[model samples]
Target: MASPQYRLVYWPGIPGRGEHIRLVFEETSTPYTDTATTSDGLDRVLAYVQGNVPDDNINPPPLAPPILQHLADPNNDTNVTTISQTSNILLYLATHLPPGSIAPDPKTDPNALFYLNSLALTALDGLSNEPHDCHHPIASGLYYEDQKPESLRKADNYVRVRLPKFLGYFERVLGSGASGGGKWLYGGKFSFADLVLFQCLDGVKFMFPKAVSKYEREGTYAKVFALYQAVSERPKITEYLKSSRRQKYSDGIYRYYEELDIEP
Candidate 1:
């Protein structure tokens, strides 16, 4: 209804590393524009990511997409502030925005945000980062076809070893008292960590449906899947999932490869 103060710079198509960032705004109904709605939108996003946007006070520019931009105090400076990296952006939003915006207030209980961020990073590390390497085992720039043999080997280890490690860790966390009996990841409260885990597993499901079905069918990692279900069913997130904003996974990190979807 109004001009959103927050802007999300991500690739136009695949979710890539941007979906978790989008989930924060969607779950909270926070106003955020995913890319600019203008002819210069692509150009501007590239400028920030490709080092065309010269640094003033901040020296390093964003080297990739999934960048977040918010206007500084209009009274002091009209320039938009840009920050990159998934976890960094999430932490920034949680702290810089009003308390209870994404996670607990850093001042009252620093441990809450600390735990939230820690869990989020763990999810991204095992589920997000490692999964990407499964397909592009040789190199990110190389096509999957060029590295099929390597992808198969990497994916076999991923689904057999890495996937269960991450899933089991979250499952135990959900069952622990700190998780408040499976509804939430920490203290029975919503956090961006929950969103991160959801996106990661959701991608896993897409990337390796057969492997996921084996676990689901065997009832392993039930708590993590339960948490995934709970997050997806949230009112705003539910709407967002069914909406056009939710892009399908394809050329991004999580990709479905028939041969690579090994049973764990």
Candidate 2:
């Protein structure tokens, strides 16, 4: 196989925020190198985070990892076209890659991109960021043990309140006829939004298995659960899940702590 035209720079050990971008690449079969597994990859990743990339042209360098760089063009500095932020990277891929890779063509339906983006953003907000906070409720900069008391309160509210709110919103979106009343999140077509939501749901299931089980048994968010099943069973995604590329959840966005577990 030919070398990938892109490079993904992110931390090596945990999937962290990079898994979102990885899903897009996996679903599209878009060949790309993950810097995490490469030699000095972490060092290279920190270079961008620390703004030590030796390039003076990359104005306002990215503040964090999961940076995507276009390697196909040599004239452009490796860091010149780098993009960070999971949602922003997904948007760039959705627009730049071949049609049907992850989303519909932006040329045909420009507005759909924004709409899908909004959906992705919402998922990250509720499913990703909030769950992460459940473990480090006081401050991400501090250890979970340092803020155990606050984390317990946050986890209770999240599983009991916020989780249902977000899930219900997506359920309505699926049933709203805006998704063409289909399994997809938009235009009755499988797009990046579906992929993103699937990942978020997967993370939630891992972190809050009991709560998700209760919700699934109630069947109130049937469409959301079905979407998760559909995305997981996709041939490419299925293969990706079983492959080495699919990183296991650890201390990342969705972490399961026995103390944080609750019955919803």
Candidate 3:
């Protein structure tokens, strides 16, 4: 029997962190099932993270959404290999799929995978996580209105300090020899890392337009914005963006509160 297709399990309706994984599939034109869009999707996602499934040795239960499950072991029909975490999923796709589909094989270039992952992790932390914190500085369980005042302070500092730090770092990376003339994050090739950065930066731009535009106008981080544009224009990505599968940034990780758009 053939192996089951790659199944991406994540919350529906918003891009959220799952988008980073989605881009990889789209970029490589790999066939996969996005469970979130199917009928009764959330119920399937809930099963893994909510402990609705029986636990065993093939794959441990996951803690949250953005799960990847593949039934690659044909010999054992019952055990599915489950994996979680944004970077972990990306790494698995990069390495497990044909090498260079998402990134160069580590055997050929020892530093490529690690370098890409490190950059992706940094973008996730400073751009994605930090922006989410701006709206929920007090607690994730609380509503944004419940923590508006503290959120204002956090958003202010993020726009002025954290935002610039991340943008500047990516800008420098674009200029570094590793970027190969302002195209990718490493070694002049489009890796899963580029896809990860593209999603994170897209979220950053959506959340802090004024500040992102300010840095763009300065031309200091020109390459950072350029890389974003390049990724946005990729044939597959462009199509995905126009498709309904590309969820809009709403209450998810990247939210645009007018007050939080303060220019740095």
- In every candidate, how many clashes are there? 0, 0, 0
- Candidate 3 residue lDDT tens string, 1-264: 554468889988889999998898888888778876889788997787778877786677788889988767645646677899999888888888889888998899988888888999999999899999999999999999999999999999998999889989998998898888778888888888888888988888899999888988999887888888999999999999999989898888999899888988
What value does the lDDT take at residue 2 in candidate 1? 42
Worst 10 residues of 2 by lDDT: 71-80
Per-residue lDDT of candidate 1, residues 1-264 (tens digit): 346778889877688788988999888788777863445667877787678877777535788988988866433435678889999899988887678766878777779888898899999999999999998988988999999999999999988888888999998999899888787898887889999999999999999898888888778888888888988999899999998889888888888888988887
Q: How accurate is candidate 3 locally (lDDT)?
A: 0.87
User: Can you tell me which runs of candidate 2 are displaced by over 4 Å?
Assistant: 74-80
- The TM-score, computed over Cα atoms with residue i paired to residue i, of candidate 3 is 0.94
Off by over 4 Å in 1: 36-39, 73-77
Across 1-264, the per-residue lDDT of candidate 2 in tens digits comes to 446678899988776789888888888888888986799988998888787876556545788888888765644444347788899999999888898667788778878889999999999999989999999888889998899999999999999999999999999999888899759898899998898899999999999999999999999999999999999999999999998877888877889899888996
For model 2, the local distance difference test gives 0.87
Candidate 2: residue 93 Cα off by (Å): 0.5
Of candidates 2 and 1, the better by TM-score: 2
**What lDDT score is found at residue 37 in candidate 2?**
77
